[model samples]
Target chain A: MVMSWIWTGIVLLSILCAAATGKGGQLSSAAMQGAQAGVTLAVSMAGAICLWSGVGKLMAVCGITGALSRRMRPLLVRLFPSAAADVSLAGDLSANICANLLGLGNAATPMGIRAAKRMVRGDIATDELCRLVVLNTASIQLIPTNVAAVRSAFGCTAPFDILPAVWITSALSAGLGVMAAYLLGKVRRG
Target chain B: MTDYIVPILLFLAAAMALRRKENAYDVMLQGASEGLKLLVSILPALILLLTAVYMLRASGAMELLSQGLRPLFALLGIPPETAMLVLVRPLSGSAALAVGADLMAQYGVDSQVGRTAAVMLGSTETTFYTISVYFGAAGIRKTRYAIPAALFADLVGFCMASLTTRLFFPE
Candidate 1:
């Protein structure tokens, strides 16, 4: 698959570059250090993912997700016309977007996967599925917590001063992403 | 206010489930277990990707590439120093954060380059990671146009971030 090729290429390129730059030791250390970081990241993310996923499941069981679907139905229909009739899919998609908008990237993944599962038709990704993925990829963050945290850590007087900039860029990116996906989908079908 | 949103949502969702007689504890436990499973399933690929990313950075390959790309990025209104962050961002979130933090530390946080890096981080997603995980979960094989579209979006985000920072934070 393409992912495999990309991974292989990255490793090979890294090795080649390290040798060329005489940074072989750094590359070795990076291999071990990066793996450690990966595990640390996974562990740190697990608790939040568990909590959100649990809450998401509870919402589904309590019909809260269904209500959300109904409330978001109109917008969801416009965004994903094919999934409009499938309430569960629409609900999952809505929850994913809601989480992303809130800057809960970890919480958004499971719902996004569920929505994609519901929309995917076999091996081929439908236009709706592609659009859903695109939307998630370029999600507009209402609160960019990580950026703010980094700014504050660096002793910035106002970490959120970049709010307006983030808002404009994120919104524009998401909008353009959706439009691009729509257009590309048409071309792919043709 | 932003920090409380997730906790508040969790509390409300739990309370609502409990009120609905949904056996909230059991359902939550099940979902949490499922989450753990998902984490385990994606660990290998995540580790591989992160390792390559870190190796590339530590080996100075990323810097070299960024140096090579500096002219073009400068033409695009992005600071030459931020080329690495922009390139690594869509591939890995933590890596991008590291680069952004470094940029902020090197250049004062209020500097145009620092602000641009922050805005870029805030606006863009880890496209490759997200696509892989979502598609892997959905058991889809052909990504087709998804990657290109997402990368294009990220490009737009990068440009917009640079432009907005210039406008709002005037260097």
Candidate 2:
């Protein structure tokens, strides 16, 4: 992919620069530090996500997911007509998405995958699946918790300057994503 | 310094409270395990980034970039060193952090470069990192236009931060 090529080029260039500068030794030293920091960051984020996911699991067990599902059923039914009105997958998707907005991508991903699997495990038609894909792709996360957390870790004083821009970007991206998915579905149908 | 501590502690407390009847510690450990896996996956990239940063610092490529960008920085009323941070910040935040620290050490933290570096650090996202992780996770194989779009947003942030900081604290 083009992204792969760009990443490769950047890596090669950095390596070349490193070798040419005769600072290889120093680089290794700094690399250790960098790796350590990355570990800490990954742990913190993953921990937060897991904690939330655990709570979500509890809510589901307590029938909260079902209660919420009843309320969200109308909207979800409209979103995926191919899906059965009584399925738990719709509720799961909704709940997963709710967690994702709160900045829990790790938790959201598994929940989404489970929901998607449930929705499609039966003999659903291909067109409906495509629609579900579009909806999932267009799932707009209003507050980017991961981005905000990273900014805070980096010593950003306000940490919310890009809130306006990110929200706009997310909305536009979601809209385009949905449109693209719909077009892909339509093309296949045609 | 003290101000930052409160928010982090509050966050930790809230994360703990989310446990309710369940064991918060166990959940956090599960999260940590997942985080550790992510860390391991990206360890190679981090190593490369750190090395690249060290080489850049020692060989003075950062200085060269700063020199090249000095005029532009002047027009924007920012220090030349700030430009290097702008480019580096997105590529590798750790390296950028090291550079920022070095700059702060060289010049007082209250200096123009120091303040701009701080603002730049605060305002911008790690563009390459975010793009790589998000798009990669989503299985987005092509970023023909996305890279430019993200970087363009980063440019806007950098310019805005510099201008805003300068306007408020004209030095």
Candidate 3:
């Protein structure tokens, strides 16, 4: 898999660089520290994952997600057609997209995973699933809160002054990403 | 604000489920259990990937690589100043923020480099982190063209962030 190569490549590159730069000690400790931090993150994320998963289930049973699908159906259908054409998948996908749009990242992941699981039929990812991932990867961050906060910390007069730039860049990336995925998917099929 | 939104969302969803009297508690338990299973499946991949990313950061290869790529990035209108941030942004969110803040500090917040750095951080979505987590949980091993396509989008984002900031903010 591609991830396997990337993971090995980074680790090997790190080791070689560490040896050359006399950072061997730091690299070893950093790897362990990174693993520990990973556990911590996963533990915290477990709460979020569980919460969202449960809330998502409840939303489905309550028809909240169904209602959302109705509102966003036209857009989602246009985005993802027959490849992942299932009624329930639409509900999951809508929840994921809406959460990403609102910048509710914590809520988005579980919903995204749920939808992705539904899309998974074989080991290889489908065109529809790839498109979904592309959309999420290029999602428009509505708030840009982290950047704004950093700017404000540095004593910027207007933290959100860069809002227009943020909107333009995010929109461009999302649009281009979807287009790229569509083209690449077709080319591969050919 | 986002903190409040999550609680409110959960409350509204739960409240609606309760109104329907659809064994909401049992439904929640079932869903949570599914999440727990997913956590089990994904924890190892998450740990390994994080370790790799951190090791890469500490080794300083990113600095060397980004520096080497600056001229290439320049062709796409991406400022040389944000080269490191562009490299690190997809690998680790915290590291990217640290880099962005450092850039902003180094070049006054209002400077061209600083605004471009901020926009680059804001516009991008931590591609590697998202892909690993999403596909890892879904148990999809062969990603095919997805990775390249996502990285391409990220490249576009970095370039556009520079162009957009320069146009709107004017240094």
The lowest-lDDT stretch of 10 consecutive residues in candidate 3 chain B is B1-10
For all candidates in order, state the fraction of native interface contacts they contain.
0.79, 0.08, 0.81
State the lDDT of candidate 3 residue by residue for A74-182, as single tens digits.
8888888852468888998998888887776767888888889888878889888898898888857787777888999999999888888988888999889989999
- Residues A1-190, candidate 2, lDDT per residue (tens digit)? 6545655554455456667776556655554655565555555655555455555554554455666677767766666664445466776767765644544445555455445545443333244343334333332455554344445565656555545544444445444544555565566557
List RMSD in Å for every model shown: 1.6, 8.3, 2.2
Ranked by TM-score, the better of candidates 1 and 2 is 1
Which pairs in model 3 have colliding backbones? none
Instruction: Summarize candidate 1's per-residue lDDT along B49-139 as a digit string, tens digits.
Output: 7888888888888889998998999898888889999989988998889889999999989999999999999999999888888888777
- Model 1 spans with C-alpha error above 4 angstroms: none
Candidate 1's docking class is medium
Best candidate, lDDT-wise? Answer: 1
- Evaluate all candidate structures by whole-model CA lDDT and list the values in order: 0.87, 0.54, 0.86
The order by descending TM-score is 1, 3, 2
Candidate 1 lDDT tens digits, A65-134: 7887788888899989976678778888888888888898988887888788888789877888888888
> Model 1 has how many clashing residue pairs?
0
